[model samples]
Target: MAQLLKMENITKKFGEVTALNKISIELEAGEILSLCGENGSGKSTLMKVLCGIYPYGTYSGDIYFSNEKLTANHIKDTEDKGIAIIHQELALVKTMSVLENMFLGNEITQSVITDDNEMYLRCQTLLKQVQLDVDPHTIVGELGLGQQQLVEIAKALSKQVRLLILDEPTASLTEKETGILLNLIKDLKAHNIACIYISHKLNEVKAISDKICVIRDGEHIGTRRAEGMSEDDIITMMVGREITSLYPHEPHEIKGEVLRAENITAWHPVNTHIKRVDNASFSLHQGEILGIAGLVGSGRTELAQCLFGSYQGKSAGNIFMHGNPVKIKNCAQAIENKIVMVPEDRKKHGIIPIMGVGKNITLASLRQYCFSKQVINEPLEETIIHQSIAKLKVKTSSPELAIGRLSGGNQQKAILAKCLLLEPQVLILDEPTRGIDVGAKYEIYKLINQLAQEGMAIIVISSELPEVLGISDRVLVMHQGKIKADLINNNLTQEQVMEAALKE
Candidate 1:
C-alpha cells in the first residue's frame, strides 16, 4: 500500500491553550486509520487542520498528499484536492430534497440553467454506491438519522472523495445502521479510498481500523496495529495510565422507597394521538442508583421527562415522595418539590453557552442567594459558586470564564453542580456520560456513588449497557414504550438486559 496522506509536526494553539503539539501521522491508500483520544485531546482539531477548517497559515504543520506538499486555504480547497469530511453533526438542509442536498454547492448546470435530471441521476448512483435505498426526491427531514448519515456519505462521494474523514459517524445510529455504515466503509476501501475515523466507541474502532493512533493532552502518544491492541491497551495509551477498572463501584446501603411513579403515560409531543410512554411504573430507594436501559426511541427519555415534569407532551402519572402523592405540573414545580433532572442533551438544554460557569451553575437555585425582594446577594452567590466548582473539580481557569470554554466532562460536572444546588431528593441523570471520555466517566461514576452514599436517590437513564450495569443497584429495561424487566444488578450480564429489551 502506498502512502496517501501525511501530516508532520502539526502544532495548533488557541490563545493560551495548546490543542495539538508536534503531532505526526500518515495514512496509506485504502487504509482505515482510527484516531483515539480523550475529550479535548485534539483529535477533532487535527482533522480540522487537515480539512482546512483552520486553514494553512493559522497552524504550524506540513501536509503532504501523494508525496507532494499541500496547502489548503479553505474547506473547498481540501475538497477540490479529493479530501472530504463528514462531521458528527450532519450538515444538510432539512427542507431540501436528498438530490438537492447532494449537489448543494457543487451543482450540475447545463449552460445557465441548473440540470436537475443530471444531478438526480448522479445522486441515485451515489446513493446506490452507499447502499441507501431512499428515493432522491425524498425530503432529507423525512429520513431517519441512519439514512441521513448515508446521504451525507453519498454527498461526499459526489465530490470524487479520495480521502474520507468520518467523526463519530455511528454515535447516534442504531446497531443495524452502524453495521450498514461500516460495511459501506469497507466497500469504499475496496474502491481504494482511505478513511480517517474518529469515535469514542472502541469496539467499532477495533473492528474497522487497520491502524490506531492515540493522543493524550494534545501530544501524540503512539500508533499501533489495531489487531493486537485491546480496548484496555488503547485506553491506557489515551489516558496516559492503565485504568485497572473501568467502573469504580462502591456499595452503599439501600433504604426505604424515596420516589415512586405509578401508571405513568405520556403522549407524543407533536403527534398527540400516539403515546410515547406507556403506563410505566418504578420505584427508587434512598441511597440507590436505579439505571434505566433501553434502545433509541424506547421511551426511556420520555419516561424520565414525564417524571421530571419537562416532557413537552400530555402526561398522566402519580408521583410519590416519601409515600405522599405530589402534583408536578412543570419543571419549576418538580424542582420546588425537591426533584431535579440533568437532561440528556447537555449542549442544548443543560448549559447557557454565553454565560459564565458560576451563573450557569446557580441558574437553578438562584433563590438561595436572593435577599430583600429578589435582589441577589453577590457575595453569597460567589462563595457558593466557588465551593461547588471546587467540589465538582471543574477544570477551568476561573468560574468567570464562559462555560462553553470547558471540555464536555467539565460542562457536565457544572450541570451536575447546578442540580446539586437545588438539594434534590431525587436526581434524574439522562445520558450523563454520553460524549465524555473514560477518565471523566470514571469520575462521574465515583460522584454518583458518593451521592448514593449520601442517601440521594439517583435515576440514571443510559444507552450504554456496561455503564448501566456497572453503576446501578437495579436495572430497568424498557422496550416499545413499556417497562420490560426490572432486575437487581448483582451478577447481571448485558446479554440478559438486551434480551429483555428485545423480548415481546
Candidate 2:
C-alpha cells in the first residue's frame, strides 16, 4: 500500500490554550483509520489543519501527500488535491436539487456555460457509487437525514475525492442508515480511496477501521491495529486511564410512584391530524432510574417533551406527582411543579451560549435569589452559582466565563446543575451523555446513580442501548409512537431491547 497522507509535528494554539501538541498521523491508501478522542482533544483541529480550514500560518504542521510536500492555503486548495472533508454538520443546500448540490462550487462547464447535462450524468454516477437510489433531480430538503448523508458523500465523490474525511457521520443516523453508510465506506475502500473516520461510537470504529489512533488533550497517545485492540483498550489510551467499568450502577430502594403520566397524546405542530405520541402511560418511582430506549423517531423525545410541557405541538396528558394531579400547560408551569427536563439538543435548548456560566445555571431558577423590589440579590446569586459549579464539577476558569467556552461534558454538567437548582422531584434527562467522552460518560453515570440514591426519580431517554441497559433499573422500549414493552433491567442485553423495539 502507498502512503496517502501524513501530518508531521502538528501544533495548533488558540491564544494561551494549546489545542494540539506535536501531533503526528499517517494514512495509507485504501485504509480506514479511525481517530478516537475525548471532546476538545484536537481530532477536529488536526483535520481542520489538513483540510486548510486552519490554513498554513495559523498552525505549525507539515503535510505530505504521496511523499510530496503539500501546502493548502484554502479549502479549495486541498479539495483540488483530492482531499475532501465532511464535517459533523452537513454542509448541503437543502432547497437545491441533488444534482445541483453535488456540483455546487466545482460545477462542470462546457465552454463558459453551466453544463447541466454533463453534471447530471456525473451526479447520477456518483449517487450510484454511494448506493443512493434517489433521483438526481429530487430536492435535498425532501430527503431523510440518512439519504441526505449519502448525498453529501456523493457530492464528495463528484469531486473525485481520494481521501474522504468523515466526522461523526452516523451521529444522527438510524441503525439501518448507519449500516448503509459503513458499507459505502467499505465500497470506497475497495476502490482504493483512503478514509479518516471520526466517531464516538467505538463499535463502529472497531468494525470499520483498519487502524485506530487515540489522542488525549491534544497529543497523540498511540495507534494500534484494530484487529488486536478492544474498545476498552482504546478508551484507556484516549482518557489515559484504565476504565474497568464504564457504568457505575448502584442499587437503591424503589419507593411509591413519584411521577406518573396517563393517557398522554401529542399532535404534530403543523400537521394537526398526525399524532407524534399516542396514548403513552408510564410511572416513575422514587429512587428509580427509568431508561427509555428506542430508535430514531420512536416518539421518545416527544413523550418526554409532552410530559415536561415543552412540546411545541398540542398535547393532552394527566400528570401526577405524589398522587396529586398537576396541570403543566407550559415549561414554566412544569418548573413550578418541580418537574424539569435537560433536553436532548443541549446546544440549542439547554444553554445560552453567549451568557456567562453562572447566568445559564441560574436562568431557570432565578426566583430563588429575587429580592423584594424585583431585584436580584447579587451576593446570594454568586453563592448559588459557585456552589452549583463545584457540585457538578464544571471545568471553567470562572463562573463569569461564557458557557460555550467549556467542553461538551462540562456544558452538560452545567445544564444538569441548572435543572437541579429547582429541586425537582422528577428529572428527565434526554440523551444526557450524547457526544461526550467515555470518562465524562462514566461521571454522568455516577451522577445518575447518586441522584437515584438521593431519591430523585430520573427518566433517561437515550439512543444508546448499552447506556440504557447499564444505568436503568427498568427499561421502556418504544416504537412508532407507542410503548412496546416495559421490562425490568435484570441482566438485560442490547439484543433484548432491539427485539422489543422491533416487535409488532
Best by TM-score: 1
The alpha-carbon deviation from the true structure for residue 48 of candidate 2, after best TM-score superposition, in angstroms, is: 1.1
lDDT of 1 by residue, 173-214 (tens): 888899999999999999999999998889999999999999
Instruction: Give me the runs in candidate 2 sitting further than 4 Å from their true place.
Output: none
- Among the numbered candidates, top lDDT falls to 1
What clash count goes with each model? 0, 0
Q: RMSD of each candidate?
A: 1.4, 1.7
Candidate 1 achieves a global lDDT of 0.93
lDDT per model vs. reference = 0.93, 0.92
Q: Point out where model 1 deviates above 4 Å.
A: none
How well does candidate 1 match the true structure in TM-score terms?
Answer: 0.97
Per-residue lDDT over 229-278 for candidate 2, one digit per residue giving the tens place of the 0 to 100 score: 99999999988889888998788889999898998999999999988898
